[model samples]
Target: MGWVNTHTRELFDGYYSLDITYELLLGGYYPTGINANSNYVARDLAALGLILSPQPPTDPLKVVWKTIWSAKVPGKVALNAWRIAANILPTRRNLSLKGYDGDTGCVLCSHDPEDSLHLFINCPYASDIWSKAGLQWSVNGAASMHECLLATLPRLNKEEVNKTLMLRWGIWKNRNSQVWEQKSKHASETFLITLGWYEDVKRSNASPVVRCRQGVKLVKPRAGQFKMNCDGAYIPSTRRGGVGCVSRNSEGEFLAGASRPHALLTSPFHAELLALKEGLRLAMTLQYTEITFESDCALLVQAFQQEDQDLSTMCLLIYKHASGES
Candidate 1:
């Protein structure tokens, strides 16, 4: 490969592209097509073109994006802000712009057309929620969600950012309720509810993972019957996946266990299906006629129980060993 331009910072001992080149494309080093620690490089590399513009920097939208991602909020909440910043929300004004023929008034306040900017920042409902958050100062002088967030998020601490994102999400939720359920919630009420939600999430994240696992342990089934628990995991970064299965007797004794790592698997749902297939195969191979399969993934189990499960390619695999199960 020829020499490439990269900053002497952030990755690969001084180069930028080489890290992705070595981690994602170097098949010999990562046959599984993912780096260790599951930091798949595909997503970051996919956005390389966006950052490598031909001209110099000055896009405030980029700053808005950076702030949205950096905010310590739930992914969905952050995503809501991102959509608002990008002016891509499916607000009534946007729908009409896209040729939708219907009412385009603001759902909460009938003062003006409902765009992302108005719905999230300008409308009286949103303004009330912002006041409840005690950050009305940020919105008083801003024109768009992008501008408001770019200025507000960078100056605030982590907790404030979380509150802001949650409040935004709650406002959107309130709008949805008004549209779909005809239920108009108060803006201050929405703010208080979302504030409580944010605090709960923050506390949950702050607690140690070890505390959650303290009392949880696998239990074996009754003595004569057999049970198999299967699970699968997939990493989005590298499209790498793995499936594992363990069987136990009624006496609560381990009988057999097996796992397989996979590459290019589509999703955790796909992996869960593979895990079930592997479990069925394991049980049949061991000649266990009374084995009951188990998986924490409800979607996989639900698909298997569906009347016609052939909707997906992986669903077909679940049937391969079905006729042989007791």
Candidate 2:
């Protein structure tokens, strides 16, 4: 007598899988509690005992109403349950390929089915591009996408993993959009879009750091409060990066100071973002929730306030960490 209840509404109505109910009564998922008169499941089981079994009992709704009367759950808990159900529920399978008129081969590599694995890791174009990006993905020899991800986990840091997941989602979405909407974007275009996904996620934190020496107004902290200033330098040809940060009290006395060098060559904008990110992290560590943020880079400050229109790819991460999830 195995019982199943797919819909939650049915479960609340004192209706349960007969097998599951029996299992619960016999002490399974949770420990058996005292058979109190006010208890829902236990009380119901005591009432039904042998009176309702073998042939499915009618008035299942009556049992449900009795249970609800016995146990009143919080509305917020119910709301959370709904949210969890929506996120974890199994979705409709992809039957779009059966309707595809083009060759069964992949649109990007022209060698395999347009499955999740092929579009993300198995395609030749994707594999080579990932390799060039410094991730040593075994394009030809990998058996499955899961294997590829597992193998690459050690090589991919947190930032890289986030980027990889977003890029994979972007690639899969682009493939579907192109085929279904007839957008007809090139493989490189899809790849670039995938890269852009990282920037989108990080957009909130990418504001450039301003120099304290600049004309930008540095809001001094209130009495007994603290503040910090930070900036970054980037030289494209040298592939060198530098970050500087200084923390001070309301009296303008230095509390902390730090700077570091990075080997990778990057543009001035990237350098500014790096400095801001570092500064924000330091401020967060010091437990300052409402501290002044100033940057010599007008564009970066403006972007932080959403007073500017344009956003660069390099600063997306800085923006995300600073604003959204910080």
Candidate 3:
């Protein structure tokens, strides 16, 4: 069943229409993704058995719940996301459905019904808030608030996602205050709490390295520690790149150096990230623990220095080696 014979392909004209090429990194070995560190025959058999078993249908909304749960947001923020997505939020439309006598028109924008989608995404006041926050999203046609946020959540990095969650909850809080207290808050005042959440996430260990025109001079390590300096170089003409690593002791004496050229590099930023991975691998291989890594890539170094849940691709790759995953 896995193989499509030539006759089968010809009989089904719509089969295998795309042209594709692949370079195999492994050969002659079955890739049992759920196998243990030491491969076993039984594990492979079990994996195959599970794959062959009849599986129940999947729920698309479950994926949205997974994303919300995985984000490093506060518990209340996640609850708010769930309530809004499940269509249980006490917006004017929802309350009216529960026999509320209050007006269903949006308190902030009297022109539209205060449903979750309109109150949070499509209303003029909400649009103004989003624009003020430097986001331009108009989801008037979206079926729900969940659909509007889920569309963009995949593109945002971890930091952006956390901030977005906090910001949306803050906006809701502001909306509630305006509804009951009958006093409006300024745009800046409304999101002051959201800004605090962002500041708190970036407050610890977020020391950004200063870039200089002359070049950043390597700082020598303290006693009993080793310093690893790294830099990534790219040649646009050949579309190739290279990285260099140098280890120094407390006296600023070079102990070891390594450099390897890259092939078909996409960008200078990618080159820098690759260089960081190499430096980390080298340090771990050398069994060095008291080490301070220095890199010329400001964004990369700053990301490592930060103490938040950074699920960005760059941060994940750096931690992949540490976790001993191939």
Candidate 4:
């Protein structure tokens, strides 16, 4: 048998010897030796085939519907409401439909059949919570949980909608607590808790202002000394670059300024070094004895102060120029 390189796929003309014994190479296949009786059928089925299929393209409305629950609304209460609207919540009615036998009456109030609509929208407890939160329109005429959420989209402003979502979520939590933990909260208490949460969220999102003392001004250099300011700019799309420098006296008067484009593409760090180099060159050519060069790159400044050897090509060049070796 001929052998071929796996990467280059080049066939080798020379014969090669096998390292393994012939008996082992020619041995027949054996069972995995795992206990078949102990194997889970579901786990076996899941591992037997490809895990995922390519997701089909979805439309705008379907996308909107799917993401409605995850919108910028606060609290787990809104999430519960969204689940109810999507009919995914494990309500008694839904569980019954899925072959689970259980009484589908409202857990809070046994008068109406328990569903998303009846539990969230038409329930007297939920209605009282909404009324206390100053949202009477939520329980007025919403036939379904989805209709109730949709009605809030246009009728209420952003803050009101957030409050509505929080209220719905809070009511669901209260119901769950009563059923599962045997703990009940009044409608007023639920509303107050939800309002407190909303207020906390608002305060956290508020932008803070930093105070600074006024009358601070830039300090100019002393007489007979020139200050040189240098900066660089680079365009990523074109891979082109440019460097600029300006010299000013102690009186803040512009002495000279130079702007030049780089023919070769380079990094911002390298470009900054080039600008400083050019500015120093200009100052030397002008016979300036004392000149203070300034740049905004902190890394470049740190490199000048330290003696560590940087092996990068640009950094080496910068080091060479800064040390007057170039």
| Tens digits of per-residue lDDT for model 4, 1-326 | 12112211221113222322122222332124424343211223332232223357665245325445544566465566557667888777888889977677878888545787777667889888877767776446766666655655556666676777777777778888987998989887676766666665665677976768566456788988999989888777776788899999989899998988885655677778888887988898788998888888765687677776443345556646777863
Using alpha carbons, what is the TM-score of model 1? Answer: 0.46
Candidate lDDT (C-alpha), each: 0.73, 0.55, 0.69, 0.67
Residue 255 in candidate 2, Cα distance off native in Å = 0.4
- Predicted model with the maximum TM-score: 1
In model 3, how large is the Cα lDDT of residue 260?
A: 85
Q: Between the candidate structures 2 and 3, which one is better when assessed by TM-score?
A: 3
Candidate order, TM-score descending: 1, 3, 4, 2
Residue range with the least summed lDDT across 10 consecutive positions in model 1: 1-10
Ranking by lDDT: 1, 3, 4, 2
Model 1, position 147, has a per-residue lDDT of 68
What tens digits encode model 3's per-residue C-alpha lDDT throughout 271-302?
Answer: 78777767777888888989988877877778
- What lDDT score is found at residue 295 in candidate 2? 66
Q: Model 2, range 178-205, lDDT digits (tens) per residue?
A: 6678665555555555565445445545
Off by over 4 Å in 2: 1-219, 307-311, 314-326
Off by over 4 Å in 4: 1-71, 75-78, 138-143, 209-326
Query: Candidates' TM-scores?
Result: 0.46, 0.36, 0.45, 0.42
Q: What does each candidate score in C-alpha RMSD? A: 23.8, 19.1, 25.1, 27.0
- Give candidate 3 regions above 4 Å deviation: 1-54, 138-140, 201-326
Looking at model 4, the pairs that clash are: 77-169
Candidate number with the higher TM-score (1 or 3):
1
After superposition, candidate 1 runs with Cα above 4 Å error: 1-58, 138-142, 209-326
